[model samples]
Target chain A: MAVSFSRRIRSLAPVLVLLALCLVIASTNSNFLSVSNLIRLLSAAAIPLVLVMGATFVILMGSIDLSVEGVVALAAVAASMLVANDFTSLDLGFVALPAAMLLGGLLGLANGLLHVRLAIPSFMTTLGIGFACVGVATAILGGFTVRISDRTFRELTLGRLFDVPYSVWVAGLCVLVAWIIQERTRIGRWVYAIGTDEHTARQVGVPVERTRILVFALAGVFYGLGGAMSASQLGQGHALLSQGRLFTTITAVVVGGTALSGGVGSVLNSVVGVLVVIVLANGMVLMGIEPFVQQGVQGLLIILAVSLALDRSRLAVVK
Target chain B: METFREYLPPVVLVLLVLAVGAIEPGFLAVDNLLTVTADTMTLFLMASGATFVIMMGGIDLSIQGVASMTSCIVAALLPELGFAAVPVALFAGAASGLLCGIVSTRLRIPSFIASLAISGIVTTVAYWASDTRSVLIAAGDRDSFLAWAVGDTGPLQNEILVGLVALLLLGLLLNGTPFGRYVRAIGSQERAVVASGIPVERVKILAFTLSGLMAGLAGVVMAGRLGSGSPTLANEFLLPAIACIIVGGTAITGGVGSIFRTFIGALTIAVVRIGMTFVGVSVFAQQIVFGLILVLAVAITMDRSKVTTVK
Candidate 1:
């Protein structure tokens, strides 16, 4: 018998996986699917969603962004400090957002420049930038949490539309921007082309190094936004709390059906992956599953997801 | 004169020690030096193990997870099973990494992703066993394995001696054995090796298994030092371990780095970390410095000829 192929089925796998997981989680507890709970999950996933989207571009180019956690922490700290708060005597008003963005962008810029100019691998450069950011954040804050009371920043996160939080809107805007950039721009095509074959792309006059730098810079921007959003929601910034997000972001992206090997992922996949992971975490927490067990399950899901999505054709041996 | 090439790395280490010592007199203290050296032993073992896998042009992200899982098993099983638990714990670690290697070889996932998946599975399973809480091996049950960490020596510590032993033995294996040659062939060009009739999967699996075993050794040592196991116990080790391997100048692209280089890298990282704390650098500044050093280390040591692209 001949099997019929369907494009819709090909794309629906991620959505179905997410929905099935959500259904199972929701069935375990009534509160799992409650608006408030889901709202929390979405917000939690949003920071990673933005970061992973940024990461996708780099990974698409066969590079990665491990500096996210550090950048996010730094940006979060900056946001916390600059906002009108009990702990902070300074308020840069709205300038705090861009100021935070600048700091994150500069670190990313350093990472990109090192890779392109100094010939360092993106892995090492990004790793260094991340640690540097963490060191800077810890030094500035003195290991203390900075609580933000800026009404404007708070309003952006705490405000809601049709009972959904402002964060969801911000996240939606980010996804839209990412999708547009990926779909319409020549740079987007370059991203895919470069992933498929960097040498050929360069031969055709694609600005490989510049595009690579821009992608990292873009990732830094997303990280900045994500970190600032985190500060707004928590009304406080803590360096240590933000350090645990890299493995989570990478796992979420992989689970959503993005290939870590590059050239085969979408922003949509990341969003759904974020939802799947965040929901699992939030639902498990709500279900009173031990944090340890939840962590284990998450690890299992990462392996399972990659096993399912990895394309065997490109690789001859796994190593 | 023939030995000058071999002696270069240690000479560098000595200079680094002197430079650090000149800046701060406290850097040479026995307690601080012993602790740093002890902490590095785990990574030393790991980097040595991975040096072989990397020499085959494959990477292992599963080291920390394997270590975590091994420690978790040791912590959970020690009192009930005594010394019998060590083999079981080690076997579990090796098996987890073996599964990852198998996934890469059979399922055709890249080693990086395959090892990542394995890390996920191992860490998750370990977490479930430990419940995020740190569990210590009962004092009565720890005498044998704790000996691997430290007992005593005339003037030096035994743990450092063990690290040297693991390195020397493995370095001999890599440089002397036919398996090492095959791994190098596979790493440098697998297609050519397969066409020549080498059993690629066998060598790949063996390398990963060795990597797992080394990580297990690290875990056992870590458990002895910390006197407990926790879900996130080996998490911090991942970066420093990789950083040390890279800093010792092992190419990440893998077919050319030596265990000797990795040993040096581990020691360098351990010294920097300890030195930072002693200098009273705040935790945040320490993070920033580690980050910068990771990049700088890679920049200094990475082999540009092997890595045409920075992936």
Candidate 2:
């Protein structure tokens, strides 16, 4: 009973710290507490929030996806080219959305296949695939920016429902679906089992490879949707659409107590982690901190948070 | 057959050169070949440092960030301090690397994540120092190290000579020293090495620091090569450096590989980079090919036995 009690308290610690941080930031910059400012923060965090959710799935399975940036870039360009864009006369309208997502899923499938079939490290495989995606994005871009005139898509992202941007709503929906998948689904349970011990999981009759591939493929779908959403927000698609997202999503997921070694975190934890990262950035900006300085501060905070949050016993070997 | 595997990378490199030259006769020109060697110098230096980290079953992603910081520092100090700024830049790189090692060792953070954070910090520092602008050394002040880097020394480019010297030094350190043996042993089996009373943490720290030092020199050399330093100067080299180490046949699993092979790997990359341009391959297509090649190399060289499961 005492052990369970302590574990509960331990889990609650990160949320408490997050709340305390918010109060401190609010005290420092009173405007940070404004409803409008809060809304703005959510809007800014919408894209990263989606990416983090996808990354959460991959991390929970004890593998990582470093190809988010490249995948997004490719998806963004592909989406733009398929829609009512300046680059090509082809106009697929709402169909472009699914097409973009399918591309991302395909890429994710490739990532999974390469990891399982070729036996390459996830990090290396994702990284190489990411580069390939970037190359593909560049080729599609052809040294020119493609402007999107898809009114429905733009309105979907930029349009606010109940005084909040649609992007946030989309992010919220993604979080909801992810939560259900993580908690209720057999594949999700298999992800946890595999992460805890792949060999044991396989012995227990878990479909290890299939589950791994499905998780990656699902994560790719999220990344693809996130790319389309980003293009909507920016009102165009460019090859560099996913710039700086790799570190941001990884940092958020890891800091949220998702073990780098795997099998020890949740969507709820990452949501709180995302809020902390976003609020921190928002608060620092409000305090007139330089963007570059904020990055350093964030880096320091990750090291501190990771040090505090990680379970040492789980890490028998540090790679 | 065993000996054949050992010489494969160099043989492949030579074949690539011959193939490219046959396709484009101008690619074999003395000027073009020399240019390729010189261009590969900084990459060679960066990979030389990273080789040690990988050989120890760790990865260092802080190369570009450390190099960026080194370049920024070198650029800012060169106007007044001239050549005296070189060592300072190297020290900064080594110190940053040491900090990364401490974080990884003391906190038990994985080296990749630790290095990633370190890179961010270092890159931020570079940005703050340079104010997001490129810094240039006056042409009149470029006669010393810059001239040496760009000039020919005997039959080889001076930058190539610098890279050769680095390769030789790292070779001796890895092949003829206890430190090298410890690194390989630790990578192959950490529990056994720890039981043997090896100061594993300290050795890991030193290896990381040495890699950082090499990155620093690479940055300074890069600054001299371009006659300017931009905060993003080495951003593109990170993947290539990792690719070079792996392609040179260094096991990503960590116990087996050499600096000399990394040199050949760097050469292979340089040829592909320059040769593609000569052969009319678009820059984007080259990136695609690089990505493919990296996957191929890792697929070929990865030791399945060493890594029970590829994470």
Candidate 3:
């Protein structure tokens, strides 16, 4: 009983911190607890939440995807140009959404292929791919923002179901899908197996390469969906739409107790972590902290969280 | 013929130069060559610093932030402290690097994560120091340094000369010193080095500190060239610097590269960049081509057998 209890406490540590932070913020600014402020916070977290879900998969495999900003930029621009937009005559309407997701998947597949087939490090593969994606985005944009005119798309953010935004609903669906994948799937189990010991997993007949490709491709699709949602929310497709999501999402995944060395943590842990980060960001803004100081505070908190949550036993060397 | 693998990058670089010269006769001109070498100095220095870290099986992502913070400090203090701000900026960068080293070594965090956080911290500090504006050094305050930096001594640009001196010094440190041997051993096998009782942690920290010092020097040079500084000044150097290291035939797995190779690699990148300009490739297309080249370079140079699992 005590062993289980200790295990439970270790797992719940991030959640406990999240609650404590919220309580402190609420005490300082009572409006923080109000429904409107809460909704606003949820909406702000919507895109980052989706990004965290995608990042969680790659992180689970002990590899990382630094291509988020690039994929997001390309998908957002391409989707904008394809849908009812000022730049091109092509009007794919809602179909543009899936097409954008496909673009992201293709790029993700490229990343996977480079890592598995060419034996390139995921860090270099994703980083290079990201640069290529940004170039594609720039090429597609042609130095102009394409104003999105699709009414249904615009409603992705403005529309509400019982007072909650569509973006929130979209994020919820992503979270549900991610949770299901994490808890109930063969691929999910294989991910942890591969991360824990790739050599042993390979010896045991695990499909390491195929699983890596699939997860990266799936993550890419999610990033695409995120880019589309962001474009719709802003009513335009800008190539630089996902400027800062890479660091933010990675920080979220790590802070949620996902060891960088891999083979531990879950989507649920990441969700709690995402909420904590988003809440802290929102709260800092509410408290009138300077934007620069807020960034400093966020950086300090990331170092603290990672230091506290790091499983040093797993990392023989913290390279 | 394993030596053939060592010669591949240089051979490719020469062929590329020949191709560019055929396409644009101006690319091979003496004046253009000098300009290219000078422009590549900053990248060479940054990559030279990174070679040490990568050789130790660690990576540094905080160069951009450290450079920016250094630039900000130099710009803000130059008017008051005059030439004295140079060391201050260098110290600021080294201090940030030391902090990163402590976090990653003592606290046992990954260098990438620790450096990334330090970058954010320094950037915030930079913004506060500069008040979110570009700080300009008056012409009177900066002209002497600028003259020395941008001016040519005979045929060689001062920048090129500074870079050459840095190249030799760093090469000597990496090749001749006991610290360099320890770094290489750590990269190849940490357990072996630890068992050897070589003070692995201190050497690792020193490598990061060297990287930070070089980045600070780059910042100082950039400030001299631009006559101004902003928190975002060094934001664009991160990718190019890493690309230089990889393209220079340094293995991302570590223990298999040198500062000399990075020097050649920097020249290769600069040649390509300038050659692209001569060919009138669109800036966006150039980025695409650069990305492709980076991917290809890593694929060619990486020791596949050394990396059992590419996580």
TM agreement with the true structure for every prediction? 0.89, 0.96, 0.95
Q: Per-residue CA lDDT of candidate 1, range B237-309, in tens? A: 7677777777776666656567888898889877777667767876666776777677766666555676566
Clashes of 3: 0
Flag clash pairs in model 3. Answer: none
Name the lDDT value of residue A154 in candidate 1: 82
Clashes of 2: 0
* Per-residue lDDT of candidate 3, residues B19-59 (tens digit): 89999888889898788889889888778887899888788
Report the TM-score measured on chain A for model 1.
0.92
The alpha-carbon lDDT assigned to residue A149 of candidate 3 equals 88
Residue by residue across A38-129, what tens digits does model 1's lDDT show?
Answer: 77887777677777777778877777787888899989988888889777799777787788777777777877888888787676578678
Task: Name the docking class for model 2.
Answer: medium
- Of 2 and 3, which scores higher on lDDT? 2
lDDT of 2 at B138: 73
Clashing pairs in 2: none
Q: What lDDT score is found at residue B213 in candidate 3?
A: 89
Q: Which candidate is the best by TM-score?
A: 2
In terms of docking quality, model 3 is: medium
Candidate 2 iRMSD, 1 decimal: 1.7
lDDT of 2: 0.86
Quantify all predictions' global Cα lDDT against the true fold.
Answer: 0.77, 0.86, 0.85
